[model samples]
Target: MIPLTEEQQMLQAMVRRMAREKLKPRAAEIDNTGEFPWDIVELFRENGLFGIHFPEEYGGSGGGVVDLCLAVEEVAQGCSDAAVILAGQALGSKLILLSGSEEQKRKYLPRIASGEFIPAFALTEPGAGSDNVSMQSRAVRDGDYYVINGRKIFITHADVADIFTLFAKTDPEKKARGISAFIINKGTPGLGIGKIEKKMAHKGNHACEVILEDVRVPRENLVGAEGEGFMEAMKILTTSRPVTAARAVGLAQVALDEAVAYAKTRVQFGQPIAKFQGIQFMLADMAIKVEAARQLVYNAAFLADRDYKSKEAQRASSMAKCFATDTAMQVTCDAVQVFGGYGYMREYPVERLMREAKVTQIVEGTNQVQRVVIARALLED
Candidate 1:
């Protein structure tokens, strides 16, 4: 096991307690009903869980990326969707912390920190998924504002975000280099929410389409320079990937816990299934994978917290995200097997966990893309 500081240990204990007491009971209900858990979000806000990773000068808790990962892991142990609400808060504000001008930080970070606002990252469009360069969103500069026109699909929290860190091409001739980031407020003219996706898992969270039509944004709202959005987005992803891995680790650990508990009480062959060597072996492997994935998640968070720029850090983050999420999928499926017929039923939490695990492999860039990133980084080294 990786050693944690006293503060981290304390944070973990507090969050774990909160997860068990507050989040665990609601997780299955949230999944079954497919309702947004506003009360849970309010609880996070009331407890100062929103902006743990931002600087204190901007109304944050003054913690780093690792702090966010730690908190996320604990919350995810109960509800992956609840954990995502916290993750989305970080995702929205990270670009501001990384590359926003001082004015932007002063204007926006405080609201996010105070949980008075929810932010969304708007980059993916109808034509762009992994190939961000294929994005068709356009932003033409006027005298004092840029008129943005296009739509962003699969945007997290699109229906309720108070602000958006949006990407659009200001100069399309330069391809990726021409992309610029902007802070678009929620009520801007011609900006509206479109379809809400009915997803298979993480039902408490919604990903939707953000439609922007001749949306006028002041030039002062731009984040970084006019041509740095691509690099800024890359930086955000590298750090976010570790947190994503932390989510997977927490979910995997929960699956293992459920499997072990079921195995001990479940009768098979006239005795407890856990007494059998085969069942014991499966549980053992699940435990091993969970621990290994946890270690990698923490290691990646460490590199990210220190702002390490080495190729090793890049590779570690991708490795953790890929390995942990893949483990989540495998471990959850194995957990379902341990429950046998009961596992396949919706009454049991394992079935819900299994469905939730599949999304981790696809989100924060697919596991396939993560491997490509690791390989490219290795080649660079």
Candidate 2:
């Protein structure tokens, strides 16, 4: 295992304890009710988890991507739903950290770090999931403001977010290069929340549609220059992939742990099922996958913290995201197999782990997309 610094180790232990004592107990109820866990968010705020990756100048802890991944992985081990909330904050603010003007950063980052303002990343649209350039959202500059008109789908925390880092096409003819990023406050005149999706997993952290019809944002809210949003978005994804991979690692680890505990206690043929060779092999394989994924995730995170824009970091991030999430899906399924009929029941946490693992493969750019990125990076001159 890669060694963590004393501070990182302490942060991990504290988050693990909090997850175990607070989040895990409520994970089931959150899943059942599909309600956002406001109390858990409060816990994260009090623990300073939200600011782990932000700079100390912005009211953060002056940590790096590795610190964020450590916290995310630990929280996910107990409750993947709650972990999503913690990670989503980082996702929403990342673009600003990468490209926001000093004035913008000074104004917004501290509020996010303090958890006084919840933020959402608005990029995906009904028609533009992986092919972001195809988004129909348009932003027209009018006087001192940009009038944004578009519908963003699959937006995390949209309904509850106080602000959004939104992207729209300033010049549709240029395709990807035409997109511009903006920050829109929640109560802006034409900004409205649309459908809230009932997801198969991570139900406690909501994803919904954000409708913008002539939402006027000031010129000062524009992030970076015009036509830089796509590049900025890609950069943030490269940096965030490792964190996503860490989440997959945590979910798989918990699933493996649950399976092992069950096998040792579950009786069959007048002996514990763990004594069987078949179960033993499955456990071994799960452990192997989880460890390998963890190493890859840490490697990517280290590279990202060093320099996110480097080609090496980009390739490693994609590779880690793809492999770790795939491992999570496979390991969780095997865990269910170990549980047999009990795994299929809602009472078993393995069932939920299995469900949650599937989303890790799908989100943060699907595994298929990650593979494309890896291949492209390999061929780059």
Task: Give one digit per residue, the lDDT tens place, for model 2 in 1-381.
Answer: 568899999999999999899988998899899999999889999998899999999999988889999999999998998889888999999999889999999999999998989999999999999888899999999999999999999999999999999999999998889999999999999999999998898898889999999999999999999999888889888789999899999999999999999999999999999999999999999999999999999999999999999999999999999999999999999999999999999999999999999988888899999999988877875
**TM-score, per-candidate, Cα-based:** 0.98, 0.99
Highest TM-score, which number?
A: 2
Error of 1 at 263 (Å): 0.2
**What lDDT would each prediction earn against the true structure?**
0.89, 0.93
- Per-residue lDDT, model 1, residue 185, is 96
Per-residue lDDT over 1-381 for candidate 1, one digit per residue giving the tens place of the 0 to 100 score: 457878778888899999999999999889888888999989998888886888899998888878888999999998998998999888888898888999999999999998999999998888898888878999999999999999999898888799999999998999989999999999999999999999989987889999999999999998999988877787778789888888999999999999999999999789999999998999999999999999998898888877745567778889999999999999999999999999999988999899998988987789999999988877876
Clashing pairs in 1: none
**Candidate 1 lowest-lDDT run of ten:** 305-314
